[model samples]
Target: MENAAWYVLPNEADIETPSLIFYVDRIKENIRLLINMIDDKSRLRPHVKTHKCIEVTQLLLHAGIKKFKCATIAEAEMLGLSGADDVLLAYQPVGANILRFIKLIKQFPNTNFSCLVDDFKVAAQLAEQASAEDCIIQIYIDLNVGMNRTGVLVNEATALFKQLSKLKNLSMIGLHAYDGHIHDSEMRVRKEKSKPIIEILKNLSKELEEIGGRKLNIVAGGTPTFPIYAKETDFDCSPGTFVLWDKGYQDAYSEQPFLPAALVISRVISQPAKELICLDLGYKAVASEKPLLNRVFFLNAPELHVESQSEEHLVLSDTKSHSYKIGTVLYGLPYHICPTVALYEKAVILDADGNIQYWDIIARKRKITI
Candidate 1:
């Protein structure tokens, strides 16, 4: 299997050609690794916010993952419309959006939709909306483990759960605790810090069982915390970037061998000096989180350095004065995979033969209110 190449001259007289290509097989391998990491009963509700593409979502679904965790109602609707039966609007939907929530419930009757709530007021609003529509809406209590982001504290969760249990149309299905602080770098330290929170959840589940007389339906874990938390905690995991590994994750797991499937393909548009070779991809195409690493070494150019980036150009430097002519195609490993993919309008997929299999970017737009 070889990559497709297009020829282009540095001057206007020379015809332009394909510079770089993205391989889909690498993405499949990454997904397979994540699948192998979890148990069969453990629900892999991958977050759709990472790669909001229908093709990627469909690929995951085809790989035996039915449930998905979405960050916005727009992503939920997109996933639901894409024939995904189980979609969880994982964001905290509060204030003045009851009508929109009602409309979504009405629109996707066959889909099993759920949302997160941390406060009593929002829970009441959700219950009210569900009652008005005569719908049974499943709800998850967002617990603030240690991230201190949007969830309610561990002490306050019991009261919220109790209040939610009495609601007519709302069903307290489970607990949603996202330990975003646990990445690959500090997995051990983060896991240690998470122990107390996991204990709290375990105890809370027990208390909820006694109060409601039933087991929690959905105890969820978010991000790369799945591996550590899933083993110690009893909950379904929702890790998004695992499907498309990034440079950050790869660096986090430096001891392990992980392949970054997603890369920004760029062409050398300028060779301003002997040392600096500029590419056609920059901050607009790749995410700016963490730091961009040199992936050209995999393409047989280890001496290259990704020095800096502009809006649409990347500056590559070779300190050793290695000859790099203009029109060179380079692949860049993104620091953060989620936002990087969101920046692109379409992703060109390549097969082993380097032939263009297809282009998919159906879910690239912002979320819809309805």
Candidate 2:
């Protein structure tokens, strides 16, 4: 069979309104496509914060994905408890999370857990906690390639790496440079912009290596610049949205060879006027991060204009004369799938053989069993 322009799930009638539906076959295909793109399984350390479900994590683990990156300590704890081999807390842990991070390391001794540290004081604090528990934790030096969100500047990387090297209980493993800012619509433009950032990371890594007297592993890039970084064999590519592709990235980067694997299944709740209708897809159901016009793309109703949205309802104006029944089901592709997945407690998984299953968003919360 050729590539499907559109994907349809089984048992559409049985699916309830305002439900998160995941195409299992499509998700598997997405994973396969990403692996093929990189051509090396070890290079793909996908982020689990996109799905936050143990079932999805197991699928990746079964597919030989031994390493993963997560944002929250809860996500890291889940991966550790699930027996993940290498789990990286991509975000720098601070405050109480530093203690929680230490607890996770002690809780699962078999699982190798590491974290990102951009600040020297934070790294020192983590070392103090780990030393108190008599545990050693690995940490990557987060470099600011461009995002400027949560990483050390390239010039400041050496000083911080030196400070981290002095810590007794903390091992400075590598560098993590996230280029989330280089998201150009044109593939060529995006790759061209990524070149300088990747060069900065390489230069910083070389400097840190010269000072620390060892080779440093580098992790870089998100979904937008994943294809660009795939060319750099030295960098471990962490692209999360590739697992469940969304319209936002797909539309922006048309050359990306992935399909939308997650969609919001909603039903028409009422018809207030001839051209106006309200859907059960409220802000609570889908992510409302983007502008109102680009919140979601209707798979069935292409001309559906989102007029307004409340907590429990999305008012839309159907420009076309096609009439939809009150219970007519509609599939919506969310612009941002990461936050959208978090809004739901569980997802309705549609498998290849038309089988239906429920997968709980286990790591959606901020806390995990200490």
What is the C-alpha local distance difference test score of each model?
Answer: 0.70, 0.87
Kindly list the per-residue Cα lDDT of model 1 for residues 75-177, writing each as its tens digit. Answer: 8877877778788888777775666666787898888888889988888888887787788888888888877888999888888888888888988778888
Residue-level lDDT tens digits of model 2 in 181-289: 8888998898789888877878877888898899988999999889888976568999999899898988998888898989998999999999988899999999997
Model 1 pairs in collision: 6-18
The alpha-carbon lDDT assigned to residue 319 of candidate 2 equals 71
The TM-score measured for candidate 2 stands at: 0.96
Which one is best on TM-score?
2
Report each candidate's C-alpha RMSD, comma-separated, in the order given: 4.2, 2.1
Estimate the overall C-alpha local distance difference test score of candidate 1: 0.70
Of candidate 2, the 10-residue stretch with the lowest lDDT total is 1-10
Cα error of candidate 1 at position 278, Å: 1.4
* Candidate 2, number of clashes: 0
Off by over 4 Å in 1: 1-22, 184-186, 254-258, 291-302, 351-354
Worst 10 residues of 1 by lDDT: 6-15
Q: Model 2, residue 350: displacement in angstroms?
A: 3.2
